[model samples]
Structures are given as C-alpha cells and as structure tokens.
Target: MKLKTIIVEDEVLGQKALAGILKDFCPETIDLADITGTVSGAVESILKLKPQLVFLDIKLGPNTMGAFDILKSLPRIDFSIVFTTSSELPENILKALNKYGAKKYLLKPMDIDEVVDAVDCVIAECGHDGTLLNIDQIKNIVQEASQQHVTKKVSVPVKSGIEFYPIDEIIMLRSGLNNTYLFHTDGMTIKSSKNLKFFEKQIIPEGFIKVSRSYIINPTHVYKYSKEDGGTIFLTNGCTASLSGKYADVFFKMLNSST
Candidate 1:
C-alpha cells in the first residue's frame, strides 16, 4: 500500500525540493496529502490531510512554544509522527511521538534508495513477523547506528572561528554548499568547512537527520510535532520551524532516534 504522508516545513525552497525528490524517487509509494510551515499551518494541514506519517522540522520560526501548544490542542491523533530540526533541547517531544508507538525513522539529506530501503524494511518486517519498530527499539537502533558510524567527525570551521560542532551538537544543517550550520541547544549556529554530506555519512547510518533538501536537523532537538505542510516543531532554545514535505522521511527517523 502507498504511504499517506504529510509535510510540515517552514522553508519555501525546502518545500519544493521535497516534492521534486519524491517525484523522482518514491513517486508511486508516497501519496502527498498536506503541507505547512508554521504552527497554525500545521494544525490546519493536519485537520485536512490526516496523513499516516508526518515530516516535521524543529525550528518553527522565532519561537517553539506555538508548536507545543498545537500538539496539546489536538483532541485525538491517528497518525505516526516524524520530527525534523536543528536543536537538541526537548526530550519530552521525543517521548510523545512514541506515546502510541510506531516505526523507528529515516534520516535526511538521505539518498532516495536509503529511504526506500528503510520504509521497505518497516513494511517487510511488519509483513513477515508482524514485528514493528517501537519507540524504544528505534532509540536503540539510532544510538547504535550513531555510535558505529561516528568514527570520524569533520570539524565545522567557519564563521567566527574554527569552531568544532560535533555531529551530535548540530540541530540543523542548512542545504547547499553554504556550509553545514549546527543549531546548538543554546541557539548558536556553528558553520562547517564542508557540506552536510560530510556529516550525512556519520548520521544517516544510525542517528542525526536531514528533514528537508535545504536543511538537516538533529533528532534530539525536536520538541513537539504534527502532520501538515508546515509541520511545527518546538525547540529547547525557544525556536520553531515548519517541517516540509520534502523532508518527511528524514524527520521521522530523527524523532524516532530521540523518542
């Protein structure tokens, strides 16, 4: 069966990029339902889309309170959640995604093949053994994956100085060759010498994530999440950003790792 999905991201270019990638990659497997980039947008989109999966970002704009507020406001939930973003402050949000239990996740800046493999793995596991990825198991996978791949981390030396932001420290890595920007829990951004791909190698196998084509965020930073075009995220640094459709799978695994 095709996966019914929703994308909730705040960035515009990021939004289009998601659609484009899906078009080329998982066209038949994904059925795009809704898209949003703000907390309000997320709520509205969810009401309409009612997707089974959501790609949510951590930074929702200037503040993350709205994202949390929206999640609390939901009267009921029937879908699985996937968070995306660049800060590592909200442990509660991660716990909530597993509140009902579901799949582990798919990291970002992810190749279409990897994503398809993860989803295929999930479905196949379900079909073969009726065993699925629970929140806790997903957590272990992320931790193990993160540890196995983190043999070498490239220091992000840009901007102010040759600051070293560990892969785990980064909450969000912007798209393109603009150098990966790490969004710390304190809300400080650390620039990298290379691009997100440098870090992707480390996180994609285990933890860390890319939520959109232009942005990659850490799973640890997610506060709250929803399914919508503007998937809302409340961060520890009091920041919020909408998760877009382009990054749906990336968001899922990031949150799965933390939750």
Candidate 2:
C-alpha cells in the first residue's frame, strides 16, 4: 500500500530537499500529500489529509513551543512522526527520542540512506495493519517518553554478544576500575565492559541520573536519600551509593525537573 505522507517543515529548502529525497528513494512506498511550514498549518493538513506518516521538523517556531505543542493539542494521532532536527547535542537528541517517541530522528542536511531506512522501517512496521497508529497508543508513548521511561526492553552488551534486560528491572549503575556494573532490582548484577561515561550518555535520557563520578542511579528505584553521610542514596533493591557534593545540586535539580 502506498503510505500517505506529509512534510511539516519550516524551511523552504528543507521541504524541497526532503520532498526530492522521497520522490527519488521512496517513490513506491510514499505518496506526499502536502507540505506545511507552521504548526497550525501542519496540524490542519494532518487532520484534513489523514496521512499515514509525517516528516516533522522539531523547531517550528517560538523557541518554547514547537511540534510537540501541536502534537499535544491534536485530538487524535493516527500517523507516525519522523522527527527531523539540526541539533546534535545529546540532551536535544534524548528529548526528541524520549519525549516525542519519534519513529526516527533524521539530523538536518538529511542523508538519503537514513531517510530511506526510516521510511522502510515505518512501512515494515505498519504492514497489513488497518491503521498505522492510534490516539491512545500515541498518548501513552508521549507520556512514557516525557517521563524518560524506557520502552519495554534495553540491550546490554555482554561478553558473548548482547543481552536484553527489562528497563524497569535495572536499578542502578556503579563504575569500577574500568567497567560499569548494572545492578538489577532483583538482586542480579551484570558487568558491562563500557565505562560509566558511556552508560551515562546512553541512559541519561532513559531516567538514569549520574549523581556522582562513579554512580548513575535510576530515580524510579530510589528508596531514600539521606544527606547525613555527604548524601547517601538507598535503592529499593537494598543497594546504596554515595552522592558527590559536586553533583548534588545538579542532581537534585534534574530530579525536580523530572518530577
């Protein structure tokens, strides 16, 4: 089936560029319905056209409000969004991935192969389903993403290859000499070859905060925070870690922001 798609981009060049890419690479799978430059215009086009997919640019206008505002106001979300952005910062990338629950994020000055892959992934995932997506599912995805909640599972590298762990089952991470150990809520620990910095970048968007130089703890699993011993955090799984005085202020700020 030819997927109906719309491009919600503010830049004229970006719109043309993406349109050209779709025409060249995704001719068979995608049918471009319309293109709009603003959030209101995009929303109206989306509702009227009822497209199966959307290529949405992240920075629409008004620094504070963007595509997400448009998404939040929509009565129903039946199409999948592939967010496009120019920012390569980790925090921005994380917000796009975790908050928007975007099917794919294409960095600006779009790559043809990446665009093709995103389109292919969407097409493959929507195969034979009457509706590509629905309101309730989108709402849940947005909520979960906003909370930095994990998707169902996470892959952790092991000696052999990789092991899948339930995101919720992870409690904390502690750095050792050269490796980081993942502490699970169920009294199980897994050693990862990557250092704390690697895991920090990977999981920071997934609700894990680095409270110290050697520890990254999942706030959901945190049982108590005691300031007595230079700041000690107790997890629900009977694990404890000390928070560095240097990171305490920022850590609390992040905690408050998440809440």
Candidate 3:
C-alpha cells in the first residue's frame, strides 16, 4: 500500500528534486498528499490530510526551529518522519528524531535511488495505517532536542542501505576476506562489504580498540581476557578474538582510562 506522504521543504529546487524523485521512482509506495514550505502551512496541510509520512527539512527559511515548531504544534505525531537537510545533524537532534519515529535522514542533493529506498523503508515501517506515537512521546522528543547530550553511533553500510547502531552495543568486529563481521550485544551479526580498516576509523574515536589486525573489540563488552595462546579476549557473545601482543599495552591502557 502506498503511504500518504507530505513534503515540508523550504527551497523550491529541493521540493522539485524530491517530488520528481518520488513521482518518478516511488509511485508504487508513495501517495503525495501535500507540499508546503512554512511551519504554519505544513501544520495546516498535515492536519487536513493526515498523511502517513512527512519529508521535513531541519531549517525552514530563517527559522532554524521551524520544522520542530510544526511538530510541537501538532496534537499528536502518529506518522513517520524523514528529515532532509544539508548539514550533519546534531547528535541530540538525531536522537530526538529516532525517538520520534524517524530512522533515517536524507542529505541535501538527494539521490533518486536513495530517495526511493528511503520511502520504501518508511512504508515498511509505517504500513498503510501508520505507527502511532502519542503526544507525550512528541514532548519527550522535543525535550531531547533541547538537551545537549551527544550520543555516539556507528553507521554501517549494508546492501540494503545504512544502519545506525549505538557504539556501546557493538561487541566486536572480525575481518575476513576484505569484509567485516559486526557482532552486537543482541547476538546479531552483520556482515558488511566494508573492510575492517573502514570501520576502524569510524569506531576508534568511540574507544573501540584494534586488538589485532583482524579484530577490533569494544572493551566494554569484553567478558574475559586470557593470556593463553599469546593472548585472547572473550566477548559477551562467547566469541574469542586474538589479541595481538603489539596492542595489548594500548588496549589495557584504554580499558584503564575508560574505567
């Protein structure tokens, strides 16, 4: 079933680009309900149409808070949101969007394939009926946006698209044949085409240590360390990873610093 969708972008070019993409590639999944630029216009159209999804821009005109204001004005947020913006979203705002039922954001200069994929994802999540988030949930999201806490996350590229995971939830990563396997706290393993080196750069800043050339481990998920067979570390998932002697000192130091 096609999702009843609205576009709330300020720029005329952005509106055309997204609308054209949707009309061209996402006709099967999206039913364009309304397109508006201002907060008041968006709110009005949203109320009148009761769309299942909205493509919102973070900055509306000179008001940086316009998009948020439209959300706050709503009686309840029962639909899904996909934010469209040029700048990297603040961590707090990202967290708020996630809480508000937005799993992804489209960067400006939106790609057609990506736009179609995004709409498909939202349709899968929203369904024809749409997911219902209460007013209190909306308020909490707004409150979170007002806060300054920056949650660190890792964006993993997959065949389907991108997956965002909290850094702390990753147990460890093991490299094999130019690909990387990510083990999560939930016992989920994601095999990515991205090489280990690619992920190393993304996670190292969050305290994940490269214990060996083939393995990177989040010390927080280290269940036990063993000196047997040179050195080895057991993860919470009971998977053991080699701990190269060269990195042992640095790894221990990192663990010490974290504690």
Candidate 4:
C-alpha cells in the first residue's frame, strides 16, 4: 500500500528540506504529495490531499494563529500531525497541558526516530476491528491521545529495507490524480508520499469510515454522528459528510452498535 504524504510549511527551505529527506529516506511506497504555505492553502490541501500524514509548521502568517489551529478546527481530520519547528522539544506551555489529561497538546520536534516510532504505533492500532476511542469514553480518550497514544510500527518496504509507521494510527486518506497522503492524530502526522487508498483498506475495518467520496474518518475518535436530510452526516467536530440515502441506515446502525 502506498502511504500518501503532504507538507504544510511556510518556510521555503523547510518544505524543500523535508521533501528532500523523505525522498531519500522512504522511496518505495512513500511519495511527496502536496505543499501549502498558508492557512487557506493548508485547509484546501488537507481537504484535497486527505493525506494519511502531514508535516506541519506550528506558526504561519502574521496572525500567528498557528498551524495547530488548522487541525484544531478540523479535529475529525484524524491525520497524524507531526509538528515541525526549530524548537528541540515540546515547550513547557504544552507540557503543562498534559496535566489536563488530554493529548490535545501538540508535539514539538525531537528527532526523525521519534516520528518513525509514532507512525509505527498508528499501523499497529489499525489492526483492530473495534477502537478504544469509543470503548474508553471521554476520560480515556483524552488520556490515550495525550501520552500513551502510540501507533505500532510497520515496515513500509523499500530498498532502504523498511520505513516503519504505526499503520493503525492513520485517521484519514487524502488523494490526488497521481499521488495520495495520510494523516494521523496521535500527537503527530507521518508522511509516506504514496498511494493512500492502498493503506486505507488496511485500517478500514478498524473504525475508519469513509464519510465523503474523498474523506475517510476513523470512527474511534469521532464524537458526533448526526444524520441530516438528503443523506448528509454531521460529525461532532462540525464537519459534514455524505451518508447517501442508500447507505444512511447501515451507517448509523454500525455507528450505533459501536457506541
């Protein structure tokens, strides 16, 4: 399966540098999919890329609303978000948030291995049919996402031997005519730069539901599920997806049983 990837860095060097590293590191199934330098571009690329993984810079633009605000607004994005910044590690400001017991705190750069390891956990969690997201409820959800939300590593085959990523942690798949992207939500998003749908099937049975023709959401982290007229589905995250009249009943039934 191709692991689709994207980059959302405002810096010219950062974008080129990361893409260069990915090309050199995981060449077999990973491909450099898309690039965006602004908020509007980030949002558009996210919807269009549906990437399984994304490399996002924390701060962008004069407003400095920050890159995380992009994901925060689209939490259902479920894309593994890997933060890119000059900072060596998570700041004290975020470390403090850990006290709240929610993994909502953002990840700061540490090392390439740290990222590879996180992706590995995502792959491992993808193997389950049911997800702890619903089983654990609110408290558990917050805690899991915070510190222990690890996705097991899987070797994405290449001459480089293996590029490991937690296949299960992947939350969404973004696609393009010739490329794809994967987005994960476990503190960071890992990028592969390949055919995302191929990996999508691996985790589909594990709470990952296709909400739109292009968007696939992980049921594990989904908090809202409202069925609207004309077969549209509204998520707790405020994102709307199609539940075509033909599939609405089955979709709700499945979500109901899981809940």
Best by TM-score: 3
Indicate whether candidate 1 or candidate 2 has the larger TM-score. Answer: 2
lDDT of 1 by residue, 138-194 (tens): 455344433443323434546564444455655666655656666775678666755
Off by over 4 Å in 4: 88-259
- Candidate 1 ranges beyond 4 A from true positions: 65-67, 87-110, 121-197, 200-259
Candidate 2 residue spans exceeding 4 A from truth: 89-101, 127-259
Positional deviation of 23 in candidate 4, in angstroms? 0.6
Arrange candidates by lDDT, highest first: which order?
A: 3, 2, 1, 4
- lDDT for 104 in candidate 3 is 72
Q: Which stretches of candidate 3 lie over 4 Å from their true place?
A: 128-131, 151-259
State model 1's lDDT. Answer: 0.58
The candidate 2 region of ten consecutive residues with least summed lDDT is 87-96
TM-score of each: 0.45, 0.50, 0.58, 0.41
Clashing pairs in 2: none
- The C-alpha local distance difference test score for the whole of candidate 2 amounts to 0.76
Q: Tens digit of lDDT per residue, candidate 2, span 165-219?
A: 7666789999988888999877989998766775654567676778899998888
- Candidate ordering by TM-score (highest first): 3, 2, 1, 4
Model number with the top lDDT: 3
- For each candidate, the alpha-carbon lDDT, in order, equals 0.58, 0.76, 0.83, 0.53
TM-score of 1: 0.45
- The digit string of per-residue lDDT tens for model 4 on 150-185 reads 444333333343355555555555555544555555
